[model samples]
Target chain A: MSDVTGGGSGADDAADSDDAAGADFDGAQRTGDVPTLSATDVEAGYDQHQVLHGITFESRDGVTCIFGPNGSGKSTFLKTMNGIVPVWDGTITYGDVDLTDEKPEDIVTHGIATLPQGGGIFASLSVEENLNVGAFTVDDADAIAERKAEVLEVFPALEDKLDQKARELSGGQQMMVSLGRAMMTGADTFLLDEPSAGLAPRLVDDAFGLIERLVDRGAQVILIEQNVRAALRLADYVYILAEGEVQFHGPPEDLSEEDELMELYLGL
Target chain B: MVDIGLFTQIVINGLLLGGIYVTIGVGFSLAFGVLEVVDFAVGEYVMVGAFMGAVLAPLFGAEGVFVIPIVLVVFFAVGALIQPLIHHVTTGDRPHPLLMGLVFTFGLATFLRGSVLTIFGPNSQDVPSSLLTGGIEVPGLGTFPVVRTVTAVFGVTGLAVFMYYLYRTRGGMAIRAIAEDRTNARLMGININRYQSIAYGAYAALTGSAGVFIGMTFNASPGMGLQYTAFAFFMVVLAGMGYLPGVIVAGIVLGLTQSFTAVYISGNAVLLVLFAIIYVVLLVSPAGILGKGEWAT
Candidate 1:
């Protein structure tokens, strides 16, 4: 379990970071340059039913994993940050700007991108088209082409499948497309919802590998995950939510010691 | 009945008419593909376009050709306004969005038809277009009416443009993303309402413009809409609902069948034969004639 997250590769991962993720996502540049995402007493929910009950948290520089059982408002909170679910009562701020009233489309322009579960893809669209859609915020064709080239370098397998429809790709490849597509936005921050939801068991590690690569590149990632073991391995900071409230939030090693709550919610 | 000249002429007529069907089907398929709405108002839009030509042509020196640009803008605006209403009724805890959209558009169709009948007084009106008159007589291939040939060109050209927009343009990709899943589209930072309106507006605009050409081909009558509505349905069903490429194939099938049945069998039996063909298609390939669309539920 210790091999999965922080303290394992702080020294060696940086060596591979530059070659693997690229200079645009240079880890050194992101360590302090990116703005902190702070959620203060955020409240939101679907129609007539409240889901998030004044949850407060902040995203760390690396991976911030939100772990919970079913119906724990993990996904809802993530939506609130990305501006998908409107903040019913409280405010969510990225760095200094209050994103409470912003729409998801507006939020991405501020350098925040989101990936829904099942690698939410345009099934009928080709891989190239999917990536192009991600660059909706960016108008410069040269910049788009450069980012596309960078994305292909990260996931070389998708190079040949640029013209192939997304639905035709395997589950693992679709996940790559989702991640690669998000990269096209040139966003500094990411909100990923259940990235490993529908993957085959062997492919789960590969999905986590992609996330680790994102972290290595220095993009701040806020992930909602059910795969506790894999997520904890990548998490620099962890939060456990039972209902809508944050039960515990601290370092990964600290949460592992709370046996009772771990068993009740995470089955860890 | 089997004279070579007559057969070739019928074939030419069928192909040309099929081109017009393609124009209507392209828009109808786009509506279904992007909005997930099986709009019943499709034919009414065409009828209204034809009527616009009828009403506005004389003002512009009686050329329906000049009415195209005006109809495009008007229908696009109307479609954009109506799309949000469709979105409102169909989304958020509304079960059976497909049904809701169908019913809404059906009501819209009725409203459009009734309004035209009321305003025009149930009479056939000519959309005079001197620019698209007569035929190009070929020594061996027979005469091809400039009007039908031009309409076919418009249909095919419209389909080509739509294909380019859908397959190559970034805006087209955004609409496709929304069609796949709205929630995901939002997560990708796509403005769902904006793109949907663009898609519906384009559909309405193209469909309406096709009406002007159709008006030039046939007189603009209040009841002419129902025939188009039926043909549009046949077009989508045969095109495999929402499948753009299949629209051309479906149009050909419809055009040839209508021409042959009207000429060889009985002019009256065309409707009956069309219905029978549709019934068989539904039974055998509910997905579509090309086996590549959402299955009829």
Candidate 2:
């Protein structure tokens, strides 16, 4: 497991001790410091057609926003994080192990959880049953019970809707369940693809708020968003992708005045 | 003029026969629901169970009553082991589940039949002294064979136990979730491979039980697999795959239809009529009576 957040800020210093002793793939050892995931010059694509060209980035202890227009490979980039889509080149290191060729199950071992773009919840399963599945990797009954309580507390709406079939939930609520289910894995890092996609403005705000709160709890978030302005507001670091390549990589403050970014990337 | 007593006996026999039909169809239904895999080789499993019962029957002296439990356990184990092979092929990302599972299981069925022939020889075998020794007269409805009554008991008990296992247990819920949406279930941490294997294993066991039931009532032969295979498929299609209760009802209905036809028409003609009814039912309700979702193309 490669330490994704190892090189970020000063957080890595405090995480160093815990990473030395704790399971390499368990939740973050040091809440606000240790790096959770890192991708270095990663080249990934679909069926021999490359989509991400030499993508390099890192997420440490807070939300790292990825905003790009359509066909910029945002979803593809997210898939590579979990090895759902293989990396053709470069290395993706989670915690201390290299994940360039690891299976998706192995990726989960590194304490990184993913909630893919849309319709990720099991349609036929009742809401609570879906939540139970999130704890599948956890074998202990007590631990599963504790995690379920924790998840329901975070998303209290799910408590009342436990028996309802998941497909019956509103799109926004479904997204919450998807994220909450990922949280059940006790993963330190989250790979969220367009959490705001197809959501109403109010629901988008709710989704963004949830991401902010997760980051506040010392969880690392790698977010792929089409809502560029809203994402920048919540992100600590930003990467602008264009046609499978990184157009800009810096703090949000640096790109605040770039008129060309708004015209070409944001289309404002 | 028909003998009312004989008619009564035939009806009772048909009901007992339907019980076995339901067991066979239930296994087929679960296999399709979980893996979208059609188990053409299911009949072979039943054949194996029947032969195993026949072999065990003789060991228990002249009466095979003691061999019943032994056969169930042995056949259940056999089903569990054979399930992995079926899963191995159907696990691939292919759309033609029926074609793949059907063709592969067919090959397996042939191999099993050949093996049975080699071991048991090409001969029909049965339990010694008959599992049912005598019949008791009903006040108004003629005498019913004690063994046939026991067969019905086994059938209904099997269905009851299967239903309880599927709906009441934690593992059962997991299986239902997988059957509904495999990809989402996997994301939620449902080990697709583990649950699927168990489902297949259970299917095998169910088929085995049905086989043993059939063997005790009728003669066990390698060729018998074909008839049961066709009947099970018909029952599944008629009852709808995945709906266990519906399959049971369909099995009984099929049994009654066959019995009534056998009384008035040729045995071969009975099959034709049954298939004709099945076709009409499918035309009206494509998913079978209580199938999942709306009708299909």
Among all candidates shown, the one with the greatest DockQ: 1
Please provide TM-scores, in order, for all candidate models, with all chains considered together. Answer: 0.92, 0.82
Q: Which residue pairs of candidate 1 clash?
A: A4-A233, A5-A233
Q: Write the per-residue lDDT of candidate 2 for residues A107-176, one digit (tens) a residue.
A: 7645677877774777667788777767666555654665677678778889999999988998878977
For model 2 chain A, give the 10-residue run with minimal summed lDDT. A1-10
lDDT for residue B226 in candidate 1, whole number 0-100:
79
| Cα lDDT tens digits for candidate 1, B31-105 | 887788888999999899999999998976758978888998999999999999988878777989889999999
Task: Chain A TM-score per model, please list them.
Answer: 0.89, 0.86
Docking class of 1: medium
- Worst 10-residue lDDT window for candidate 1 chain A reads A1-10
Please write out the lDDT profile of model 1 over residues A1-268, one tens digit for every residue. Answer: 0111111224645665544344353222445556788899988899989999889999998899999999999988988888778889988888887888998888887778888888888888899988988887766665578678878989999999999999899988999999998888777778889998889999999999998888777788999999999888899999999789999999999987899989999997
DockQ of all candidates, in order?
0.60, 0.32
Where does model 2 sit among the CAPRI classes? acceptable
TM-score of 2: 0.82
Candidate-wise lDDT, in order: 0.84, 0.75
